[model samples]
Target: MLSQPETSEALSGGSTGRALVIHPVSKTPPGRVSNQVASRSTGARLDEAVGLARAIRLDVIRAEVASVSRPRPSSFLGSGTVENFAELISEYEIGLAIIDAALSPVQQRNLERRWQAKVIDRTGLILEIFGERARTHEGRLQVELAALTYQRSRLVRSWTHLERQRGGFGFLGGPGESQLEIDRRLIGERIARLKRDLDATRRTRALHRKARRRVPYPVVALVGYTNAGKSTLFNQLTRSSVTAGDMLFATLDPTMRRLGLPSGRQVILSDTVGFISDLPTHLVAAFRATLEEVTEADIIVHVRDAHHPDSEAQRSDVLNVLADLGLDQPTEDGLIEAMNKIDLLDPTTRLGIAQQRLRNSQNVALSAVTGEGCDGLIEMIDRRLESASRVVRLDVPLTDGKTLAWIYQRGEVLGRRDDNEAAHISARLPEEDIARLRHRQRLH
Candidate 1:
């Protein structure tokens, strides 16, 4: 659990006070400031920080990028910069200061005291968003586990009661336990229990995957940076009613649906939590069970917001996260790129994207909002799946309409001939479907 004064209200949607979002650009040579992402500008990073703050309903009164030539160990910012923000906080009466970087426990505490406001770093802000956006039981568990893991390291005795000692139960007791120790112990116990529950969740997910394999439909997963229109594209592809919005971390829970391809074959389309630059490691580990839906997907779609200025940087960030998840091959060669939000692009840029798509069969330029070029994406998927299927011949009784319909729905028909007694059919199908058809024949 988070300490009440530090994060209880801020993370639980109780705090609606004014906030100041700051992005610190580090100066490597003591003279030049550089953005965190090599291709992204400083303003973009600050904008993202502000967006993150607003995602949790924080009333952002001010936002800026602070250049740091050298960091002070106590505050992670130069003394003058700290004093400058302190004045801004006082002037605007800001109740919260969002630092767009990871802060050590001491630095976080010192900054809060200096600014006379609650301070949460990037990790904390992201966690707060996750805490608010998580709706499912599993999502809550994963968020809680990640939150606890992150909070464990920042136990800097923020409360006065943490220093007090509890009396031992024994009469001739030696030293009693301090409140901080008790809190740490309790948090540790909760973490252990959560890990056990998550392990069970992982096992359950594995079993579900196995069951899906039994009646196998190729799984296609949508993955990209937060608010890159993955959920929107998912809705467009599968015709689902999942909540899709233009907010960061808008969709936390994984949603799956059955989708019919152009070839009349079907697939399982999965919309998963979006990836982001500098996504907390604890979150990546804790949400392993949920992300397994991505790792196990037969087809991976890398969606990009082509209209955004930092599009290329966001692409690199998403690929970095995928690499961390041990999915190197997908981003390298196997994945399909969906250049989303082309409806927002100017005609010249959209034309360029169209030309790029003509050069690469795996690249698709589409707008999930207007449903433009989405058919092209579906056709691309259909062609890929068709190329991977094997042709097989089947003979069915004229009376058995069910099996014939099943074959037609599950495979691409190449040829068919009807006789008085039976129908001979040739179709392209997956090996799993072929085996199942053979098994169905044996049962009769």
Candidate 2:
């Protein structure tokens, strides 16, 4: 059971998805920052809340920022604040009010009573988006598991609806438990089953990743805040048509494609689900299986929308999530920062960006949309992946064209010597190829 103050609010209310987006500007704790995203003005936060609502096709009737301090235990806002929203809801005929703050369960119910509308906090809203966006089987299971965990403790509000709306003979349901107990029992059972399914899914995904490791291609994962041009950069690099959209969470599932570097070396580039500020803890735990791709990656490409107002704050959120996943620091050799979307920047900003990129060897200043500076990004990836591996000398029979061709195809040959009977070669290659050459030499 959640403490009355700390319980995550998920109200069950009357609605047809029409919403009023509200961003609460509350008092900051001592020594804590008031803003999550730097300079994210209350109006901007409210706008983002409206965007979240629109992401799911919700009809946003109104949006505003509500200023509050030292939250009232009963409603999280002052009486005046609640009364103001009540008037807004009545005038706008709003069916839903999305509070852009974590609300206790009690606060949610009180808000609903005062406004005569359904109320949901940020966590609940994100869950709804994930539910609507999840397409793959694993994604659905992950969303369901998170939703169940979120719904578990909020069982207090929706029980009345469950009791009132059913057409069933109360007969052999004999001595049926109260609606609350029934919901608890059903949800408990479902949650248990979802957990089991997700566990199996996690193991299967692990096996798949292990199989990829054996295939000799290093995994380069693209990570950033949602709508950070990851998919755009991925498509530009790999020339594969992946869905890139202008909305948050447009890419919910992790996508992987074969990427060919300028040196003719192939790699597996992965586009992962983006991170966000105030991400629900339930989601973090639930999506761990999918996010293991980030942990297991050989390289992490931090894609940033250089034009975004909250770019730095978004970067902080991504780093925090990475740190939480046990990656305290990105690999120095394999890390790259693609300051993408430069096409959207002004000339002065572009000059500054160029100077910044010059300071950081790993930084790639590229506009993924216009195909600018992409070759440099590829070269950066190649250099980083190569720095760890060393070149080796090898000898193959002159008549063994197949073996020689394979070596040329898989390695960067620095030099080759031709003799009547054999060919000597010096090539930059991984140990896997070196071993393969030695095995073939023995067989010959």
Candidate 3:
């Protein structure tokens, strides 16, 4: 079990801190309910929000639902709701207000002033989790980039004191001190440096990818909503003890391991950071390098918690993130859906849905924890890989022994026969390598 910080002070670098959760729900119109209405179970959302807050060690004194407000403004609650929140803040002596929704900097600042507390929106909370969970240098860089991007908009809040003027001598009393200005300038420089460093990291990652390609193994990436059992599935598939938990954003660094499919084909499977709704744009931008794994994947396994009430919504959110990563094109045919955690569902329902999906030529459903249906999933992956491969039958001249040797070394030779004039070879090769071989055959 992941340990929670004993107090907010231990987590946030201070003792005088408390958080109030504000989730503004808009009332539906008289006749029709807009699809955009907040329809998620308030209890579930609150549970998740509280879990996230606790993970960050925030001292959440009180968590409540502010009044449902209209025209949402994508930020602070309505003026009236803000007023109520102000009163609650005073009553609770809250030091921070954590809005469950994404908040614009303008609205964030306004809310902070009204509540007389620091305001951390959903995006900031996620970034804080990433900052804590990132372990690798590349992962750290990605998190830092995302955090900086998120902070850029809120710089005004962080440096508000910069606007104040210090008491100075008539001409130049030792130059008025401006802590906020200094901090802002320092942060700006750090952002620039991080960008440069990330650029280098991206290049390093590119080189690593090139090396992997030379080994010629297919790459399978696991992607899904936060707490959708990605790490569990990854651990199940790879037998590697990566951190797995029920909390949101439990795994931050992308983990890769070699997996042998049922057909005896080996491929690299990577577990990436989980996606979430209303993810901050800066966080996405900063984590672009980490997500690039998805973009470059030979196959994408979209894992989801099959028993979750919001499974469909969670699927939508995962796809939205994939779209943002430029993997939304119709040409992305290698995508597979893994309805994970089937053990949590009724046996009949799980089997029925799995059978239905299989019959429809869709992907697989399995419980990553119990290992149920795992073999079928592996077989499905193998079939997909086989379908995408190119089959080649080469008749090489007996004198061209080097070519025959090369073919044997580079391809998965299915059959071979020696003839007086040539050696007939049947093999399965990657589409690109097959094309190159055909071009070379014609040239020779």
Candidate 4:
């Protein structure tokens, strides 16, 4: 858990606030930033950090990558380096310093004092984004749980905002219980309560999922790095009006819609929250229920920004997050890759992507903005779903029009033979649908 540092909005500037973004690269062993994907360059990672701050309307005044041979215990940067950056901070009147690295309580507070500005680590910034964008009650609860978990660890940071803010009787302490201890107790109680609520929500979500399973539509979930055009592609395929934007963390809550395939088969297309490098541990734990949609999906579609320079790195990051959720996430028929935003790619890169697709049947280069190659993506999904089905034979009485209609509605009829009193029908259907149909018939 990372503490969410306070940010100041400059009242004088026409913009929201002046923000300084920095990506710290360390060579030493301890406190090294390991969450970053191996393929993403340090420069690209800094650019992403800047974009994250901008997502919340922070006016980035300066950005840079700082090289650190070793981390200092007090400020996480050498005294000279800290002073140098502090000079720049004072010169530019920057209100926020977005550090693209994890910071300890001591390091965060010391840096804030030295720089005379509010400071936040990568985890804190991500949490702030999740907190702001979460719409549903469950989503908001999850964010709060994560935020509180983070705040609990920063009691030693000497933040004025956390001082005497929580109200409670000091029975535990005889006379003068420090504000820090009271705040910690309040946060702990809140965390436990939130866990209870989240557990109940999880059970409810499970029930909802079970009901969806009975509907017999296979679930296809879309996942990718932030700003990968998932919502755009989702709207393009499902004809839904889900909010789509060219911003980071644009879609915080999971959304699902019944999508019809070209084969007359229907599937539930789920657009989930985007993944990012070094996703906070608390967030991963808090949003477990929301991400269960991916785990339960019959087929996962990985949407990639074809134009992003770090697209391959982003793919690796998404896969890593899925792995954390215990998903194998193989690039087999169960996983289809949607190479989205091809319209933003150059002619040469677009052609290269097209050539690359020939080597991988599980991937389709597409432009959600232009409706190009979407049909191929749909056809690919149709084929994968079709391959998962098997043929089953059923006997229905000639008078049972309802059962026959149900079979037709749920499965592809392969063959039918009518005898004197009953109809012998052979049809291809998903295993779950077959079980459901058999269960329905047994109940009748």
Best by TM-score: 4
Query: Per-residue lDDT tens digits of candidate 4, residues 1-444?
Result: 112232233211222257889899876567666654567888888889998988776789999888787788888888888998988888888767878999888998788767766777888788777776878889888987887788787764322222222211111011122333326777789899999999999999899887776556788999999999999999999889998899899999899999999878888999999999889888899999999889989899999998888999899889999999999656596899999988888899888988888898888989998999999999999999888788888888899998887777666677899999988998777777778877867322
Greater lDDT among 1 and 4 belongs to: 4
Model 2 agreement with the true structure over 210-230: per-residue lDDT tens digits: 676545577899999888999
- For model 2, the local distance difference test gives 0.76
How accurate locally is residue 176 in candidate 2, as Cα lDDT from 0 to 100? 26
Candidate 1 displacement at residue 8 in angstroms: 9.9
Residue 412, model 4, lDDT: 67
Q: Following a full C-alpha superposition, what root-mean-square deviation does model 2 have from the true structure? A: 7.6
Model 3 stretches with alpha carbons more than 4 Å out: 1-17, 31-43, 59-61, 67-75, 157-185, 330-333, 395-426, 431-436, 439-444
Each candidate: RMSD: 8.1, 7.6, 8.0, 6.8
The positional error of residue 66 in candidate 1, measured at the CA in angstroms, is 0.7
Off by over 4 Å in 2: 1-15, 28-39, 157-182, 393-444
Error of model 3, residue 263, in angstroms:
2.2
Query: How far does residue 410 in candidate 4 sit from its true spot (Å)?
Result: 9.8
**Which candidate leads in lDDT?**
4
What is the TM-score of each predicted model, taking all chains together? 0.82, 0.80, 0.80, 0.83
lDDT for residue 1 in candidate 2, whole number 0-100: 22
